[model samples]
Target: MSKETLTIEVSWPASLAVPEGSTIDIQLWAGNDKAGYSMIDGDFSTPATASPVTLEIPYDSQDLQSHDGTTTWDHFHTSPRLVHGGFIKNIAYAEKISVAQTKGAAWKMALR
Candidate 1:
């Protein structure tokens, strides 16, 4: 996979509910602290029962993910890929990112 191919498609089942009082989000990464990307496009806190929302993330070096009210990617070797991620609160308690894909000339992801 090339740098351009570092795309991720995240979806949740329509039947299941996002954990009550919590939210779900997605992150796309080139590498830790390497200007990754993320977005929360769904009403994960209040999902619909009919259709599973699909979020097509368009990420790149230019559209880097950031915290602290910024769009820049997280800091080098940052604890959270997002600097000011609201989910940081969640990360304080649980694992938000379970799988991650590293994009380069070749691709690899978190193992099962």
Candidate 2:
């Protein structure tokens, strides 16, 4: 089996209220499987006011399984002393491969 790296980007809504100096916990699950889990704990710091925030999370492709060329991913967020809940709807993960061909070469390699 080969390993691939995937980066998950999440855009946070500006309307969500977040306390200053508080940390936001982010969790990623592959489908409904509990074994396919990845977490970014306390990695996000809430600003003084709500604003659009983007988070870039990296994961191994082996950690997630795709069906029909698409994989279902779920994200959750919470703060200290707050109940953990889903932050957004289901996210679809598709495998994207880019290949570059060089001169004098009859073939190219797929890069993911």
Candidate 3:
């Protein structure tokens, strides 16, 4: 299950008004076929510019250990607000990931 092939994009739109030194934390979680979920990867960074910060994460299905037993879908949790002075805005929704997409191919997750 070590499918080292998930791409995660963390970005802040230039149009959004964010404080100068604000930072955001993103946590990525994926679901197991069984009734559970696992945290795949996460990052905390400051978007000092308009370009997106890209992180290459491994799905590693073998690592599934039911971090959250209450959910059956793939989802991510973000920091409540930016570090400096503004609320972080999200542009994407959590979607259910299929077994094939979770174990076979690379998945692209963008958090804006």
Candidate 4:
């Protein structure tokens, strides 16, 4: 089953903090369709003058796979907290994704 095009903006109070030299490992979604996404395209970098800066990622993709059968990554990042991801673009598609909180963390799966 598909979910409604979802947009989630999760915020933490200034009191809540991440250690220095740490990046908020998060998944960014790009469209509205509950079709669990796999390959996504985006970028993250250490912000200049960084001080607990929240990175706002605006994304949009259509091909999202679900977890009914589980998925594997072709390549992965060194950071254990950083999950594996991938993607492709062309033709046309939808726009909203939902964030599923998993493993004491959050995985933003594009329901497209």
Per-residue CA lDDT of candidate 2, range 12-105, in tens? 3454444454333344444432333333322432222223333344444444444553654342222122112434222223222221111122
Which lDDT values do the candidates have, in the order given?
Answer: 0.30, 0.32, 0.48, 0.30
List the pairs of residues colliding in candidate 3. Answer: none
Candidate 3 Cα misplacement greater than 4 A, ranges = 1-3, 32-36, 41-48, 65-92, 96-112
Backbone clashes, candidate 2 = 0
What tens digits encode model 4's per-residue C-alpha lDDT throughout 2-95? Answer: 3222222233334433344443344443223444235445554332123333344443222233344344222111111212222121111232
- Candidate 3 local Cα displacement, residue 44, angstroms: 5.1
Find the 10 residues in a row with the least total lDDT in model 3: 74-83
Order by TM-score, highest first: 3, 2, 4, 1
TM-score of 3: 0.49
For residues 1-112, write the lDDT of model 3, one tens digit per residue.
4454554455555666655665544556555443334665545454534435554554554544455444344443322223454555444445445545534444444444
Give the C-alpha miss distance for residue 67 in model 4, angstroms.
Answer: 17
Better of 1 and 4 by TM-score: 4
For candidate 1, the TM-score is 0.26
Q: Compare candidates 1 and 2 on TM-score and give the better one.
A: 2
Which prediction has more favorable TM-score, 2 or 3? Answer: 3
- Top candidate on lDDT is 3
The order of the candidates by lDDT, greatest first, is 3, 2, 4, 1
Pairs with steric clashes in candidate 1: 65-72, 65-73, 67-84
Q: For model 4, what is the error of residue 77's alpha carbon versus the real structure, in angstroms, after optimal superposition?
A: 20
Stretches of candidate 2 above 4 Å error?
A: 1-17, 32-50, 65-112
